[model samples]
Target: MTKSFRNLIWAVLLVTISCSDAPKGETKTASLPVYKDVPYLQDYSIKYNKQGDKLMLSQVFMDRNEVIQVASSEGILRTHDGQFLYPGVLLQDKTYRPLTDKNITAITIYKDQFVYLDDKAVLSNAWAGSLYLKHDLPKANVFAAGNDFEFLISDGPMLQYVSKNKKNWTGVLDKDKVKAIKFNKKNSTFWILGEKSIASFNPKGQTLKTVFQNGNFTSFALLHNKLILTTLDGYLEVDATTGKQIGEKKTKLPWTEITYVDVIDGHLWFGSTKGAFMLKKDGKFDYYYGKRWLPSNNVIHISKGTDGSILILTDAGLGQIVYEEMTLFDKAQYYEKQVRNRHIRLGFNATLVDMDNGNFDTGRLSDSDNDGLWTTMYLAGEVFRYAVTKSEDALQNCREAMDAMERLFSINPVPGFPSRSFERSGYKERLHDPERWQHSDDPEWDWKSTTSSDEAIGHIFAYGAMAELMDNDLKDRAIVLIDTLMSHIVRNDLYMVDFDGKPTTWGRWNPEYVNARPKMVGDRKINASNIIGMLQTAYHFTGKEKYKEKAFDLMDNHGYLDNLMWPMKDVAKAPDDADDWSKMLSESWNHSDDEMYFIGYWGLYKYAFNDTLKTKFKDAIIDHWEIERPEKEGAWNIMTALTGTQEFDLEEAAWYLREHPMDMVSWNIMNSHRKDVTFLEPNFREQTLSEVLPPDERPVQRHNANMFRLDRNYAKDGSEEFSAGDIWLLPYWMGRYLGVISAPEKNN
Candidate 1:
């Protein structure tokens, strides 16, 4: 036969033959469509109904398409042909029947008295028809649906329902007071709205129970047996079965309305007027507001497909997020992007050290072998150790810089030398600069040596780190340098309790600007409070009694215990005294705030073998405002409860860190352009709640800024930044050390 005739004969034979083998029972499977990102169409919404699916664009345009017919089964949007799509198991006539891709006959669309055809086979349309329900009825809002029903939130206030009957519109909500609505797809239940409360509704009970009664709810969702609510006050996740609230996180942003609520891969996604947030892995909120992801801070709607693609509707436009399995390389790159900044040092190789700013002089006063700055080396070591797996070129450059500094120390007479000035030009150019080759007396003469102590600690840490990196040769050298410095302190009994010989002398950078500030007199005295801590650290690392003795004496006998201001009392100081140079007793110190305290002490207490001191150290953890929920401010107030010896209560701190899931914050604090702004940083605000505000008013500000990364660093040109140590430290002390290291690789 001819080629054309042979092809026709094969086509006819295929058409005539039955596609299925078993006449009694055949399993059918369908593949869901992969969604791509849209340009910028705000409020792009989607909802599946009995007749078909509806897509709304910008809340002004509505498109209708036939996804499922009333006669067919209702299941997930499993697989699709060019013109038709299949869903998951369908519940019909009391029988659960699974549908497959081949079973989909035709896709249709339904609008105002008109049902469109899928002849063109487009999945969604911008606008299909008008709403004839009522002029006062709110515009159509999209909601996730299963089986026989789907929810429709109108622009007006009423939340209605569409059932399996193609043309039916059931007014499940007869009241006009409904403000927010969320469907528990897992429980197959809906949360209706009350005046200032929320009512749980199931088909069995006509009278809904008031689950939330204190304030008005803007938006809410149900996930993992809990009901997450976004209100004008804060974000709250409550027990679905009981009326009790399981987790309630408040924010600074006024959530008068929640545009959308989605529970994706166990995380609660909240879209509000302020921004879009993901309930982070740490049970805190994390904001997604950068350039690559969210187009607008104002989120109006959100939804997800069976393929795990998310459609976010913002004030500016719609964002499509396709969440697939990320490779290890992808995750590593993500973290590197977050922690590394190339703009500030685009032509250089050193990590941008944050010391020497604010009271620390922003690191500009450093004059020592400029390349010897241990803080930058420490940061480089921390970042490169992990980043080496991704980029070897970057790793080698970091290694070379470290080696050069090590050589400088080897050639110099100083025992353990610290880095001073960093060159603005490239490393090659930096090698030739006079600043890089020599040390400066100005840094020490001007009392800028406090950083020297911090840098010393960094050097010590870098030594251990380098030992891990350079195979012990450089590490041994590092240890020798460290020992040399320790010997200097030991010989001098260099406990600097006073700047000059007198207690009232002005020898250092004092926040209160007071002279000498009542130095702690000891056989061994240290001029700097920060230095004492460093001495303790040095002692811990080297097993030197002299350093330990000095540290213990400074800490226990001479009011060094009182030197660290209690965060509660200090942060509570009046706003006018916010920057007061007269406040002698304060909890915070330069660069080393509460976060540093927790990070530094976590290691210190873990090694000290003193249970009592550990308890005190933990008790001192300030539960200030969280970065995520600023409207209801406070940091992880529940972290202590979760890990400390404190009792375990569902509503307490301990339980909250593990279960009090919230979102990340949107703004940066260090770059916030104010010295006192540190008080508002997530770490300060959340961990030190008692000091953040008065006791009587604490409740209102408890959950504000729930999404902040407190210990995070940012770039001068405005970009995201974090620290490897922070990643390792936050999770480690919070009893999530495994979580921190394995976080990127964890299965969703």
Candidate 2:
């Protein structure tokens, strides 16, 4: 039998199944409970400049509950200041008196009190039972507090033991120059870090011994029984008493030029010329770099804050990395506020562009080429939110975005053709792609043209979803849009024709345009998949037989089913002899197409004309998902749950949600120099590493960007901040709607 005859028979059977009690594939419900108090890292930066009244901070230490900084040359010890000041006693306030007026050469903590050595004497800030030791060690560069108000002070060569009344004892480093000093409570000795060795001074014995002699020792921190030493390159752990090498040199680090090392609360933290990092229990370092985690990349010191936070002192200022308790739902709420506050422009999800050094206040909402697609994603998210929680706020958000989408079709002259975006008139000079924008009949408006296939699929996906899961006017409105757009496409022979009487570039889905590409080309599969999904969605919502007939005609007579069913692995570079367009399209996997395909899957499988087609679409989706598993993408993994598959990488999905940095600012992130990541050879798929870095460690990007991308310095000063509307809230709300992620559990 001919293909047309076969499709006719299949269509008749579909109608019979539809009229009967045949099951329409429904999403499986899950009840995975997530609590509200789950702890996740929420990072922010506090920057300070040296030009103003802000002191040039060289050293940082936690004094009681305050983060105190000392400027050795200026003889200043005050609370460090920033745009967001650290919580503590404000020493800058007149209430907290100054310790001294003389220039301070060194400072240290003795019995929880800040002690400093000046040219005149050794003094402290302790009001009662204060310390005042008269000393002649005018060249004291470093010091550490010892027992009974005694301090072991060093001037590179000479070491003096100063007591409350006088300089009691003095010693010498025979060859090495003293760089740092730390009093070890475990040994009741002062451990000295020298330029070329490690030594200890026994205050009781008044003897200084060079415990370990090495030419590369730069810094040291005394752990319980071991001493963590730093060389110019890396760090090592050695026995405190023997000062011998504990293991092979730990040279493989985030940055090899280690500048400082310290141990706080039994955790090892390192400061390098590049950034500061902490060693986790899993042998991996939580790397903190760039302005997102530091004021400057050159880290000078690392210390534990009074509140168990890590204070990273850099050349410019301080960065405090705080861990806040928050659940995924809490983050979603935060992003929801962020979207409503700054990201919406005429109800379309928009970007804040031309920011000044990642300052959110300096940015303005801007239009984009994919405004409809982005708004569709965001609208779909709110649709799911309203469906799950019945939140009136979410319903209102959906209504606004839906109105914006509805305007895209009516604002232009082309019937049922959604514009890429619409803007107020007289912005032709400043808007993106000025040539593509055209003045509408309305004197106050202009609409962007040349809408792509992705936008069409996205619009259909959101409308179909709203029609199925929403209520009343919203459902009716969505159904009408489905019919309007699908009617236009079917009437125009499967193409979105523009006002100039031609199919828009990338809006073609006719057999001539789609089947012309090789089967291995990804556009063939994606275009076929998207159009069929759109057609299925329109037919299901509008009950339009023409949409169903066109869909089956494409699948049966035009070989669209075979085209879309091609294995994802087989999609690769086109043959060398192919046309330039085909070669360009197949050079590598387009992550944007992944976004389009997964969004299209909602319509493809959920509103299938029959259960048989639904099962086949499910298989296709799973096949694509298998290749995408390595990414561990939260959105893709959650979307895969739409097929009711048990193994959808749920843990990885949750991991992505948790690991995503709370700061969505487009900071210049650099992970290419990291030592722990396993780099992979170049390939067509653009997978840069064997394993991808956690979301917080890399640059913030939308789901359409490669997850394995290691570095992003697109704007050296970070001039843009992306909205979380489409990036974060979408996946989270989708998971909640699909029942894969449960609502926040109540505490007992």
Candidate 3:
């Protein structure tokens, strides 16, 4: 044959091989569109203090740039350097410049200028304006500004209306004291709030009209010609023109000690002695309390801020709830930064502990009982992120986290046994569960023993993902780790033999121990599911027939298939005749086991030896996801999307990610006192409410905790902050890899 013909044949053969070697199902992973600019609230605080004493913040307003300005008993102080401060004393900075040196008691925004009431006069900060009303009148307790040099002033007993620098109308309540005065632009009148009455004074007509009376009014605001009056017990809405109550008194609020009320941006906001809340369009309130959203809980005033944000002025500081427009992808990027900055310790997903009231600077990354599991989850997320984006940073993250996982096995004395965690040797006294930590061969390091099935399953899931999605060294390392772990389990008769050369508690998956539990017990089901998935992953990656044989033996002879595929509804409390261990295991649904089941599902469905078993695993995963639908867990829902199913509650998963608070500090959030939620009777699943609260509204917890939990006041003062690794990034990157969630759409 001719040399040119031979070259042509070789080129055609190379092309055919390249096409065959390309990734399979690339077209199936095509991404869709998740539009950008999704609005969500991001909160921060601006504190004002004098010599360690929290200043008494009374009123808050915004300038044209949305910079917060406060009217306190200590004059007009703004936020610290026009920036948010943490939970610490804020010394006076340049942004604390008072509009005036005089004792300003009240302030209002009139035509984008500061019109304030001082001890000597009512003055304007406008360059061309003058001090129109002077101290010739009683001390001004409250004031409101109106059209072009118009002002309504009150001093607890009488009201004075000044227009064009002259007193136009004077009004007084017959037996009440004036508390607040506001100008209604719709009718060009001054609505006066009293200690016991509501009245409107028309500056044009020079007439005063009583609107309503007989309630202890603390504050009032005008909205669409209606008046919202705050009382000691609750609040009332009154029609401005007819002087009739709009509806029944709104007493069923989060806090009833209503100190102030305002209608900002068409939303009703309330400031109680406890905190501040906004009435949502659904009639429920988005409660903001504790250090998570405020510097202190004693809110004194609320107002509209720039870009439709809410400015909550508390006795201690200003809590600005800024509604920033961002997509879920943007949130993921934010969490990515959070994890890298404060949550990584020795490449493990760690928590920042011993914080001084949620101060990130005062905390240290601490070891956890589930360090292996968390790191595995974070490693898997980075793998998926790298697969989708081909990001070099993600690849490096995967390398570091895989090194940590690999060291977990090598650090322990027992072959193929992964340690729960490891830290510097001297920290045994300071780390968690000192008894579980032992000195490794390396003098500088210590490894924790008594690892459970949770770590095993997590390691297998991550390794399987890396083996499938990564290249060269990563894939080789993952396959080797999978083989090492599965070989140890198989050789030791399906048990994670510990340093003591015995099966660790909760690491046993042998048929003898598995069949001993009652069928309804969760441990039995979780162990069976995890072992099968691990074995399948090992067989798939390592090409080990022994691993496949062990899997089939368990499923065909030991009822492992039935154990895993049993309907979730049927898994419940153990019967009275069951053993004590079984009863203890089935007392309530274990959320940790749910976490394990879903993590294992990645391997169980993806690496199933046959299409029949793959179909069965899909049914099992969807069944578990359906039972978890009420919780609206982002990780679980997104993981369920792996089954290639259309109805995986994708919207709810997006809501979970969107609603997660930017501040992860474990603050003292209390929702049990809320009146709007529908509480459910105590059930086996420990679901506290009929409907679950949003992620930010409830306590911050891992996906393994019950989402229905309504309170988390145990942290003396937000002493801990959780990492977003397993809780947030895992689901996000998994959704991106699965093509259910798209990248941020370009703004036109």
Question: Which candidate leads in lDDT?
Answer: 3
Ranking by TM-score: 3, 2, 1
**Which 10 successive residues of model 3 have the least lDDT summed?**
10-19
C-alpha lDDT score of every prediction, in listed order: 0.36, 0.79, 0.79
- 50-142: candidate 1 lDDT, tens digit per residue: 223332123211122222222232322321221101112212222223223222212222331122112111121223322222212323332
Higher-lDDT candidate of 2 and 3? 3
TM per model?
A: 0.44, 0.91, 0.92
Model 1, runs deviating above 4 Å: 1-254, 260-270, 277-293, 320-398, 407-417, 424-450, 464-470, 487-748
Better of 1 and 2 by lDDT: 2
lDDT of 2 by residue, 1-748 (tens): 1111211221211011111221123454332322122334454445544334454556666677464655534555454344432222223323345555466777666666667777666787675636778766787768888777888877888888888643488888878788988887776898888888888888777788888876787678877788888887787788876767798879778887888888876667889888887776567777888877777788777776666567777776667666555567888998899899889999999998888877677788888889999999999999989888889999999999999999999999989998999999987454556667988999899999989898898899899879988976999999999998888888899999987889999899999999989999999999999999999999888887898999999999999999889999999988988989999998888999999999999998888889888889989999999999999999998888788776787777877877787677788888888776678989988999898777888889988899998888864466777888889999898887776665664323
Question: Per-residue lDDT of 63-171 in model 3, one digit per residue for the tens?
Answer: 7766556776667666654334253333332442455456778888877666778766778756565655665455876888877678888787777777775556766
RMSD of each: 18.5, 8.7, 8.9
Query: What's the TM for model 3?
Result: 0.92
**Whose TM-score is higher: candidate 1's or candidate 2's?**
2
Error of 1 at 99 (Å): 31
Pick by TM-score: 1 or 3, better one: 3
Can you give the lDDT of residue 293 in candidate 1? 39
Clashing pairs in 3: none
Q: Go through the candidates in order and give the clash count of each.
A: 98, 0, 0
